[model samples]
Target: MSSMAERRHGISTPAASTQLKLRFIDRDEHVYFWFPLLAGLSELTFDPRQEIRHSALEVLFDILRFHGGSFAQSFWVRIFDSVLLPIFDHVRAEVTDTTTFTSEKRRQQEEQWLYETCTRCLQHLVDLFVQFYDEAFTLLSRLLDLLRGFMNRSHQSLAAVGVAAFVRLAVKAGPIMNETCWEEVIAALLAILEETAPEARDLITPPPRLNPAVAAAVATAVATAAAPISTSVSSAISSEITPASGSGSPSGGPSAHHPPTAPSGAAMANGGGGAAPVGAGGRTFTLREGVGARRLAKFRCQAATQLLLVQGCSEIYANASQSLPPGAVRGLLDALAFIHRHAHAADMDMDLRRRLAVQQ
Candidate 1:
């Protein structure tokens, strides 16, 4: 009766199936109706279409849940190799081109989707290992390698997510992570924080101001020195002006032309410029549109990434301070101190600065 019920639900009961089909879902014998029907799902998980790929992952998760530890160890290993590792590679490839999206909103949406998907994948993988802690311990070193790859990404959003995920795993693994693993984790986190630290001038410095008297005197002197140069430039332009097709000069003599001129003061100050000043090597320098805004955005992103790192570092320290060796604790403290000096110098949000301060 039990065997009949198991067969009805399509469960692979050992009683009604050969040992080979019952253990390895990949077995050819399982292609028939009585099997668990997982054929081609692994291939589908790597489909080029996003919807298909997502659906396949969802189905795999469901299958894992339904099996309730009934699957063979080899089956789990196969999932790790084919499904989990490949999904991670796919995610990295997708995220590498995230900035290529022309629209800000679209880029943000895609990043958010990737973050959620990556988080879900990490959570599921870690939870699986946590369930069989003793047996799965060896596999987690590879998982740490994956986490390190994510944390090392140049994309700020993905890096933050990686740091958060790594911190969670580190805390969960606790003493399970050997000394070398713990050292590597701390080293990686500190390197990221150091790389992302904001420059002091960009954050903390104010623009210089000039007195009214000094400004007025400077302007008068510049205008006086520039008057003759301006006249010479106008003469040069009139001589060089050429007729455009049939639109000859009204008077047919260089059209009495005067090309647009730079401000007299600036032209003379910049050493005989007709339009604008040129830098060394005759290269013109122009401020790009929205450069300040772009720089500010970049600064904010770096700050945010650093904030995540700091928080993760603090969490790791809190979790393992007692258990960590004295040398490890000293290294963490040095990293934290370095961050404290640099972060306080940067003009970050008061609340975040205070959090760092308090954590220190």
Candidate 2:
């Protein structure tokens, strides 16, 4: 427990602990001593007990963080191929299963822990020993797929963690992450925005049912009020009441009016105003002024803010911008425009919004 706590918080270790581990590995020039232990720990990662698996991952992460490069490239490759790859495979299978567990709550808890451990281990490995990444391209591809799967999951918490991990991986791997991976991530985030957008109708409560006698009286009152409109300019009113079409509000409910596009400050570089430019995927997602639009703008702004932060803090975006596929940079630009256009609409801290606007 104490060791686990120490590892979790990254407590500074004494020279003895670090030296002893290095000395043991150095003494075992053949790696006969460490290989079996690594295998055992890897096996423990799949243990039925969450604590055991978490503890095993903690130990492995610490080992990699402290002395990962000490081993030969081939040794690390073997660890990735034999140990990490299998764990990713298991995670994929578990995530795909549609079967209902006897104790769903417990299962969800276990799955969350598994995802957390997997993400942390992968991040640590990539951060500490990126030199071996090219050699492990196959494994890295699988890891990316696992991350995409996590992001596509219905569970928001899991998906949010997946997004963070995806960003971290991009920041760590830089040029190594290909365009296809970036597209997948961008698509997933857009889907999340669409899914989470709130409907104005959903926000508004329906009026309480009136009493039977009151309902009749209300209906009569409405009929009498409509009599004058029907008598005058009936044809004009009929022409104005066009059937609802795609240009109208979304299915969730009707809005008083379509939300306006983002402000000029949020417009895409190539676009003149707040109109949503087509993304790399050939989809145009427009921002409006209604509740749903505001909700979506909030999410889009937040996602873009995080991406921009990663870009500024690391070389990933700079490296990626040079090799970006057609429409990719535009998609990113659109996100940035949304952030700026609806800067005031988003329910975010004014300081943060100001910082984002300044970046724009």
Candidate 3:
């Protein structure tokens, strides 16, 4: 009984003793081993084998999570440049190079692992430092740009991982995400849904808007300008008018300027074609080519990935709605509804459709 009590009094277990030691250990102790450890791990991240790279990244992330703020900014930047940035370039190269793998299945498996590692690393970086460091916002923007590129790739695996990562970022980083970041994420997700469910594209797509008052004014001005040109052209054609001074050569009959074409009011009102010149947000919006049924089938084949994205959508709606701007919130709501409707219409499993309806 005495032995038991004595043992329990101090350093009772390995964990307890370790914690006790940690409490007394100066933060400066890490300085001795930090760079050396980072150096070793940084080398491992570039290894040709995926497993080694993944393990190295896991260690790096663990260090960041536990002691992220303890180190100098330069150390963190070294990790960012040497360890994090290289992984991005490596994964991208691996995904695009078809000759590396002997078979498609192996390629996909390798790609999937690479993508999952990339996402896990990114999540650790953003979740650990986004609030405390200003540099993190820049990282967040770079993350969005990377994910956007991933979503644009032809591989279903790439798109799936991109969407999943995007959703996670939005749900986790909602408070810190600025308006531009929010819009970019929202735009990327909608682009995915638009590709996966072409039939419902119109439902979620934002219609081109020109202020009615502006449209009316522009149309009136165009009509007033076109009338004189039309009358002049008709009279010139009827009279078979010759060149007007320097407008055309005297020997050239019925000069090109004689039948000058003026844009009609409707054409001007339509913004030159069927689309608006620019959006209200000061961005030019253009739709991609229509996604085909084969692509939809590919999306269906990756049901797990699709479900991940759907759950992410629900999470963003449930947890981040208040943090988002009004426009983004409205866009998310519309996206969620569209997903539910498409799932039901496509005869997707009842549970998925339900998940879409329930936020988070």
Candidate 4:
């Protein structure tokens, strides 16, 4: 009995002692080895006993990978309910309402930890809860709301990540999803994804932003501007009119002021036609092609959003690979890639919208 009690302190065995030693953090910048936090959290998830395991789960500051054999495979509701849900509520409260605290220093400190821990735990729960999407709809829905909270408050990184995670859950939920779920979830993801990729800061801040990488990705690809009108729109209303100047009357001979014709095939410039003047030898450029275009101007106007999504997807795969086994990364990569593909489809929708505007 005495030995068991002592083991509970993480000192009875060499491995337990080492784990405890790893958790001994002083908050001193130099002595900090944050990576051990990963191992400790990993153990907490895989611990054999349910009660001790749940307790262990509480102190974790990071999520463990259950993708391969790394972490034990199991439905983690008891741990999630006993350890995660309450902690999520508390962390959420701490980061929210900066004014609730008396001092700015305290508020900022709380905000930093709150945001960090919030994200870490969120990823953990999401990774675990995903398998049980049908059974855990309520928990998943609440989590989606918590994630959206970051977006509502201008937490860009958190918001981007949260939206992406939520989208994944919704897709997995299949027919279980509803219209309200769409509003609470999918719409936000589309809105943020549409923002100018390169200027995430200009990309109208979602509720509270979340994932810095995603925001950075956004800044890398997109910008705020008019959407592309259409891929098939070869020329404007007045573009193909040729270089002939409008004549006063039919009796008048060829308009004197007009040149014979645009200098050869001077590559249609912006101001080339009769009403408008083409640039650089009466030839200007415009986008009239689809995805196949070498560099679609409509796409350029977005600041390369597709590139940003691909990068984010890559990051997701890389991060998951580090913690997960090869088998697990495949599903995660597939899901994230799906999100990336959907974002591209949304861009095409923007193209359609632009074309419709030009037509009307």
Candidate 5:
């Protein structure tokens, strides 16, 4: 009976039937119809038509709802290698048919679809990074460059959430690298953090007081992450991070970078990316002194505001533990540890927040 039902739902793909055995929805609650859905998503990435591509993205995103704590460990890498990477490479080069001079309206519409679609996928990827930071460590440099390009002036509208996505990834990625390398990422984040912070009400008001708790996380990330490989970030960035949209591609110029990822979240400052300003214009900004309070507050996770905050956010994963079918959580945890290291800075005030965190 179950086998017949699986076939009716289009869950019986070659890959799913062979490797996955049963549809994620049918076989195990731990992984809902993962076998068939995962297989279907993998195929969608290679579809030649834009419409097909869009549909595939949507389905994969829908499935991501089932991915969370455990699912991340079960299926993230399969998506990364089999689905994301391939689609990333394919979509990197936007197909331009000379005959199909897509009108401005058409182009804008397509871009909008892509933007929304990417956000969904990117968010899931963020979950993976948070769960398995180290698994996604090799992706840090790539992610940094990606954020800059996505949030830059080129794609102003799309960049809004794009910037947030970058922040989450940075928070997660920063801790996985060795000390020296980690600083590089943090330096970039500090610049971003500074930009997001309100202008200290005439620069004399102690610089937008920061949360001792959050500062600790940022401090930790800067303190850890990345190994010193004598290579320049700019150079490595060229090879590592490719914008999802063939960014900076001058209509007919160079191709943009590609590595399709999940969605990210951030708060706008009337707003913001990269590099610490030298000497802070004769001022000082260090871990000892602490970053502004507003920056710390962003990731604070208001337990109360959870309803409002998650309103627009599609309830993808029912519980924090039920999603990410397989092997994904490891990646998220590794990344979360990294982000915690840098963004939280809560460590510095752990003794204090410890009481708070414990209460929660």
Candidate 6:
């Protein structure tokens, strides 16, 4: 009677069908569907079209979110080798050009998008399988190598972004990172600061140019005003002009009118009359001699901030710090001091000043 009732309702056959479906999924047959999709996505990473690349990364992110944890270390290594290595190589090649032409600029924009996408995906994987990180030294070394390449590139914008990515990784993985890896990270950062320091010279102020029309008007007004001077005043002016003409002209040649050049050496010295001159408006404009120094100092401060944050969150940081070379610790302290000095010397933002103070 029960068998007849089950047949009538169609329950027994449907239950068997559902069980078969479950068995297929449990047997890992689902990989057949996902493997092809992932492979296609990985290939799409090399597509010249920006939208295709973006879509591929987005789909990959979704797939990773669902299956990243289930993958073995060997599988992860394969993914890194086959998928991520190509993308990183593409980015490195793109940034290497350093050209600012329209097409190159467009290409750079695309490369930046790809780089950021890869970074996010890497971060997600690192966060998802935190335990795998300790044993994934090879993976970390590859990432650092990529970042180092970016840092050494001629493009300041690209290099800066690379430094930022390095900082993010250091902060995220500081507690788990081995001492040797941490040292390498620090060395890379310091190298970036040193490399960028020379670029600060490009930021130096150029000599100011006088407007021709304004200069003509001023000259006419001065001539008209000087014509009516008394004989005594004229003699006094001649007396004052004689010495200047003598100093400007050798062998009693005609006095040449030359635009003033920016002073060097003694004129730029720190104290007395050598100090940077104040303008009529009471603003003092000083030449930027240490722009790179300031930038490096800021970089150090950022690193210190990350270290402090990691220390606050995990006891492993204490152990890691103890393992760090003494010079590295001293370098970090110097960076903090540099930030403090600059904050006090410049008209820095109050909020930033407060934050630095608190960090101190």
Which candidate's TM-score is highest? 1
TM-score of each predicted structure versus truth: 0.53, 0.41, 0.48, 0.30, 0.34, 0.44
lDDT per model, in order?
Answer: 0.57, 0.51, 0.56, 0.42, 0.41, 0.49
Question: What lDDT does model 5 reach?
Answer: 0.41
Best by lDDT: 1
Worst 10 residues of 6 by lDDT: 242-251
| Clash counts for all predictions | 0, 3, 1, 47, 76, 0
Candidate 2 C-alpha lDDT tens digits along 131-181: 555444445555565566555554444555666666676666655657775
Model 3 C-alpha lDDT per residue in residues 212-260, reported as the tens digit of each score: 5545654665778854435534444324322111112211212122431
> lDDT tens digits, residues 73-138, model 4?
222333444445665555455445554655888766555555555555566566555554544555
Clashes in predicted model 1:
0
After superposition, the stretches of candidate 4 with alpha carbons farther than 4 Å from their true spots are 1-83, 96-102, 131-140, 156-188, 191-360
**In candidate 2, what residue range of length 10 has the lowest lDDT sum?**
200-209
Off by over 4 Å in 6: 1-39, 46-51, 70-72, 96-131, 199-328, 334-360
Superposing all C-alpha atoms, what RMSD in Å does each candidate have to the true structure? 18.7, 18.6, 17.1, 19.1, 19.8, 19.2
lDDT of 2 at 197: 38
In angstroms, the error of model 1 at 190 is 3.0
Full ranking by TM-score: 1, 3, 6, 2, 5, 4
TM-score of 6: 0.44
Ranking by lDDT: 1, 3, 2, 6, 4, 5
